[model samples]
Target: MPFIPHTDDDIAAMLQTIGAPSIEALFDEIPAALRSGERDEIPPALSEQAITRLMRLRAQGDEQPSCFIGAGAYDHYIPAAVWQIATRGEYYSAYTPYQAEASQGTLQVLYEFQSMMTALTALDASNTSLYDGATALAEALLMAVRANRRCKSKRVLIPRALHPFYRRTVRTIVEPQGLELIEVDFDAASGQTPVERCAALAGDQGLAAVVINQPNFFGVLEAVDALTDWAHEQGALAVAVVNPLALALLTPPGEWGAAGADIACGEAQPFGMPLSSGGPYAGFLCSKQALVRQMPGRIVGRTLDADGKPGFTLTLQAREQHIRRSKATSNICTNQGLMVTAATIHLALLGTEGLEQVARTCHANTARLCDQLCALPGVERAFSGAVFHEQALRLPQAPNTVLERLASEADLLGGCALGEHYPELDDMLLVCATEQRTEEEMQRYATALATILNAA
Candidate 1:
């Protein structure tokens, strides 16, 4: 039997109560042309084997091109075990733990994820997860505004060096709430947000926070220590936007300066999440325990139950859904649970040393590829600074022209063109070479780029 919740009498009673003559009257507002009249014309369902074959045929149309673009989403090798375990029925179908105590297994995985994030960021605490890196930064900005008791002003110093998408997302989320985001310029030569530029804002009385992106959008490492200290000197919180994998090699935000960054957040896509065409990626947000209450999303905590057995439960139900809407710390309704599960398993499979190795390999490959590409005529470094796994190269010809030719002729998904966002750097192309890129692949890319440039 089809599990229909309402009987004929129940439907009739509901329609009568609502002053509708029949159930179809509810959708009378919808135009007849727009609606499918009936299910009679629907095709018969295919058998299991036939469906599988059809899906395979459809899948063949999708091309897995060698990816080099890493604006925010990354391409990293996921150990087969990461997804195999994450996609298991137990972990895959789990949702937000609203009941708290009942969903022990789901809550435990989230707890582990929080623990891992704190460890990686070297922060006092971490929330379960957020929508993605961009929104996480937006949340961090809002959290800073709420938590900074000393700075009453909603003015935040945001660097142009931060990812362009993150900056736009932050503006969309916080501007309506009366938060003012002040744009700070990066040193053109270094692609680093100079402390001197931020220092000018010292005279401004109510600076809420300063946003710092380590190995920022251009992949050039920022002077985080100087920037963090500068924000503190101005009576503002320092919000660090970071790449999770880079934390393994670079100085974690928790140790940025004499006092350290107050909050750290970024995308966890590099961990175990695949770049499924820029979708469903996980974001992580960590903060000093002082700002924990102001943080958004679900926070899973572990403790012992009455029987003295260990247990996991949701702590700090700060969203509007759980608390009085007016008193809620954040309007965010839920966290990215499945992505967090995959990240937890990914981190567990690759311990501290293993994660560090991956970071080192990514850096090494990027540096090598940068060197090879720069050797070609008209191809030069866009910024003269040390980078992590991504670098911007100044192409002789138009970036789109080169990218289109590379894709059509070489079957290569070329790097992102900086022209769209940074008009001044229109000739530049930002590329990344993760640990997944091999020596041969890098050489191929270099050769293809050279040919395209030479032809142009």
Candidate 2:
């Protein structure tokens, strides 16, 4: 429906019908200071053409930097058709599929998204979506505590090598709920959380879950099979925090160990979404079939309707909005519907082989970029281990300083500085090269970095 603002006459009529003297009278219960004071507070309305021109001018002023920074969110090539289909009238405006009979299209899109996620992770089931990767892991931790009946402890072992932001988010979300998140340090040489470290904590502590991030925060691959099995041996659920794109090339969490990970969750932004500033990204969470009821958010299922025709509707919704608050698995009210829609469309367009090819190209490009950057004097790989795409490098000069020079002098984004997050790695920079990055762009970055270092 198009927006139709009320005119003075319309407002007055509505006010009279409601026994209100004016629109202001309706908000009399609110404090006068809190109420909007002036019409000037709002920007002046413009014609459609005028607004388009204004937006174009504003966009022109913005710098379109070639981004190489992929801590969690990534820069991947999005097909033109993905958004074209996703933003169609029905899909774009749809929110939660509260009315199943009337929302078959929306429900089916979510159903496909879940199906794809499960296939990507090799898990049994998946939720519709979540706020983002960070919050999704938080929800996964909470679910782990609930689903692990054998382990009575609320303690969860989180690797320090996991994304720092995700760790903080999990703490914020689960700490108040009486969950204990024990930090397990990563090996300095490998940038991986060694299974032995987790083994040390495996006695009678009764851990609820252990988080394993494949191609961890530093982009160094972890011993997932060993770690997954270790968690199982401890009778704790293995919570795998993964990169959805990397899963195309690496072992899926469900096939991680002898038994496999119980839960797998990660950012699904690379599937289609752009790094608009930072986000509007979606998170995907998948788990074993036994834990489906404990998984937060809705799950869509295909069924035969009264006419014996195929239909899609919400099969399981564990959020507080769907069930009794006390019995609810999570308080998350809704999924990132629009982003999920785009991702589903993207996956359908790409298929399995296309996605695997993208992942392989990203890995190859990143490897080449790393080799180029490391060839320069006083730059070396920060950690020694296999990586999917991203890599952390040690530079002679301060990373932030070099990054500033790269951005200003060469019009390059360079990469993320690791000093602020890991003080021990004060001279390190984390860089990534997705399939979007070309040979010329990588060479440009290397030349720019070498120039900056030589000048220093």
Candidate 3:
């Protein structure tokens, strides 16, 4: 009666085989006083139409807002075909390629994704994917430390202007392994990490790596080429944390220095993935081919079987799941495959030229929005450096209070406040407008902030 898979006879046979009289007899060793005495409080099933109506009513309770916040996640416009094609029965899956033959489609899609990323980063190789931006950054830092055989110091220079969340994550992952994350200061005025400070670190022996954020936490573009060169000169590996979209306009990390950055990694959410309450997103890591084995996560490669037909298979799977934990490059077991599939479909449809336009449009929209917002009486640019799609702005009062006022009183989701992550910039708010934001929406945001400022 209880929806058990086995019939009474089968249950009896199983019970007899297990030396139990009945199902209740199996729990004889357990104390009755601690057991749940009452049935779960579940309502009776509703009619289909009633269920649909009820769901609609519940959905109406949430007021979906036009997104304006882009500290790390941008609200880029996703084309209809991106998800439509990606969700096709064969493509929509959450499985990693454990079986080479059965997973050719999955493996091929991942391989393609890798190729696209390598081309984008101008690096020789890319791993399949990682969990998120933070973990990928953690792995990249660890990779640098592992690769630096000559550099005795396991100290990696992290810029103060790097995203606070990422910096924290790196510290959590690396510090436990006895690797030090040294904070490098940025130029106070321009919000860019000073190359001179990095050069100064070079004099200190045993510097393993330097982490440079292009279009850093304040959304100010750092002098990447200079920073990369400094790291290389110090005999330290340069790990460039960058936004994938901005690479369309700025120099790719692979081409950043005289020798280029040793590693390139960043968030891939802007590539047609929704900022679903800060993800379910993917992080991508790319390195020059020389460090391919050191790259964490999985790699899919094109190959030929005995028939000499081209096929896809998992290659360079350096994880605890594949090898022993001690030998694994990273303990990161799985990847955001669904999101990667979404991104692959998204990029394939957009192509190189289309993606370039999307990047250009985001920058253009943010620039226009920046001009309008800064024109407000109490609002001003927080930094002098050029930005791509986001920037930190000086506000009249604490940004948290102002952002709260805007969101509740005006039904608007304002940009991220800097006070919590960046106490030094207590009066700053990181604002952004992607290509998805219209001129009208931008004006409304500015107007809302202006009204709040005037009231103060």
lDDT of 3 by residue, 1-456 (tens): 434478878999999999998999999888988777656697766877899999889878875675678888888889998888778877775478888888888889899999999888899999888988888999999999999888998898999899889998888888999898888888878888888887676546668998989889888999888888888878899999999988877899899989889899999998989877788999999999888888888888899977999999988664445675778888777788888998998999889899999998888887888898889887899989887788889988888998888887666777888889877889988888888888788888878888888899
The number of the candidate with the highest TM-score is 2
Residue 33 error, candidate 1, Å: 17
Tens-place lDDT digits, model 1, residues 254-304: 999899999999999998998988869888999999889888888878888
* Candidate 2 global Cα RMSD: 2.6
In order of appearance, the predictions have TM-scores of 0.90, 0.93, 0.90
Candidate 1 has its poorest 10 consecutive residues by lDDT at 315-324
Candidate 3: worst-modelled 10 consecutive residues by lDDT: 316-325
Off by over 4 Å in 2: 5-54
Best by lDDT: 2
Candidate 3 error regions (>4 Å): 1-60, 318-320
Ranking by lDDT: 2, 1, 3
lDDT (0 to 1) per candidate = 0.88, 0.90, 0.86
**Prediction 1 global C-alpha lDDT:** 0.88
Q: What is the per-residue lDDT of model 2 for residues 355-381, given as tens digits with 9 covering 90 to 100?
A: 999999988998999999999999999
